[model samples]
Target: MECPYWLTSSQVGVYGRAAPEDFTADYEHWKRVVAQSYLNGIGISWSSVRNVMDMRAVYGGFAAALRDLNVWVMNVVSIDSPDTLPIIYERGLFGIYHNWCESFNTYPRSYDLLHADHIFSKTKKKCNLVAVIAEADRILRPEGKLIVRDDVETLGQVENMLRSMHWEIRMTYSKEKEGLLCAQKTMWRPKEMEIIKSAIA
Candidate 1:
């Protein structure tokens, strides 16, 4: 088979867009490394996690990177970002356009896992972050995992919100200004809600 010229380190494909440091010859390998490390840390069983979403997909590299995994990735390009949905389809992957400030058009607990790369920083300037966090809680399954990579400040704020929802903060790491947070959602109910249910019963 003939190799695509754009797959080389020097080219940005037909879109001619993507992070400059991204998509080197080792791009896919780097993603595989990241996926392996995080999955090992979280102890996710591939048998259970069938569907995944890349919330801030740029050039669909994250999806391309996970080709070896026994999972499917839905690349979501933020409406605020470049319109690269065409490129995603061109690569024979899946994708959609979305605005994080608004709720995604799907039922609750749709995704088994979510990879949010720098989504908070971009969405924060325009909308109430509480709404965004609530939406995340809505879309992820009860036992689903959320992997967020964002600036340290945003991660701090995000941790507080997720904690408030009773989601377990499984792991958190930061280097200088950037940060990573892994959390697992639970079906925990508030004490007040339980009391109300008891009274009704």
Candidate 2:
């Protein structure tokens, strides 16, 4: 079923921020832009993907964007961001409040896909990014995909970290310092080994 382009937002004309219409248009544009990555670059197989998590969900737009797909999204709003969770609930969507610097409450391998929009740059000043990525690894299923959008420098840093983690870099593109990266988690782990020393005469 298709979701209506407009949603009921109590923050409208009251939050005194941007216009509600502007937010609607913005997220709609974001939805279209994200769809392109799926169509051409990352090539995510939605058939097997059932669980999705929007790590820095703003007004639950990413979840709205994928409404047609047979998947449910856990829209996670940052504690530092504005209070938009109420608006998300008003729109018939559910989500949780979280601080990415800390851990998200869930089991290991809980999600099939995790998407973050500029979250790394935002969190780097506040906490350790390695912890955030490690938490992501703990929750994402094996071979699950992760998509991130950030500045080019942050993208490069995260790409290198992911490579070290043995995650395959699926796609990366940077446009004027704005970048996007997609990677798939692997099952590789460090193996224990023993070495024997030989004495030479």
Candidate 3:
């Protein structure tokens, strides 16, 4: 059995005159792809339930993947509301899913992989995939992985930053011109700290 892949999506759906049959078929195809990659687990976080409702025509694949892969699922939104964080925590998922967008601070030193699905894009000028990589490094265990897929203009910059940080570039690919990069976190030596202390003495 191969290791499963993790997936995250942003605003993926059909709307406005697309036939229901076509919509449903496309959604199923997306889900099957997600299911096949269910190794470490699976997660889906939407900006709103309404935003995801029309998208659900594609979610049968998600549900089927969850069933076949025994993967975990989560839903989140930007605004804090009743039963939001509590529900996510109750499910034992990576909790407070909305926090990923909270003004982009560095992550605390405690997580493993930081997975981003469709968060970055050429049209939308908001998300920073490199900051996300830094945050993942700050929080991940040594040799951990960061999985990201997005519409990026500078794949080389992402790869270069990871290498400068001593992270290993594991994989990269293109899907319809969108670049996906997979990098592994590596241990950072405290050589500078040691040298500074020795000089002071």
For residues 129-199, what per-residue lDDT tens digits would candidate 2 score against the true structure? 77777778878989999999999998998998889789999888889989889999999854853221211
Error of 1 at 42 (Å): 3.4
lDDT of 1 by residue, 119-140 (tens): 9878989887777887788788
lDDT of 2 at 99: 86
Best-performing candidate as measured by TM-score: 2
Q: Candidate 2's error at 159, in angstroms?
A: 0.6
Clash numbers, per candidate: 0, 0, 4
Instruction: Score each candidate by Cα lDDT.
Output: 0.77, 0.78, 0.44
Candidate 3 lDDT by residue in tens digits, 9-29: 332333322234433564465
Better of 2 and 3 by lDDT: 2
TM-score against native, each model: 0.80, 0.84, 0.50
Give the TM-score comparing model 2 with the true structure, all chains together. 0.84
Worst 10 residues of 1 by lDDT: 192-201
Model 3 vs. true fold: TM: 0.50
TM-score sort, best first: 2, 1, 3
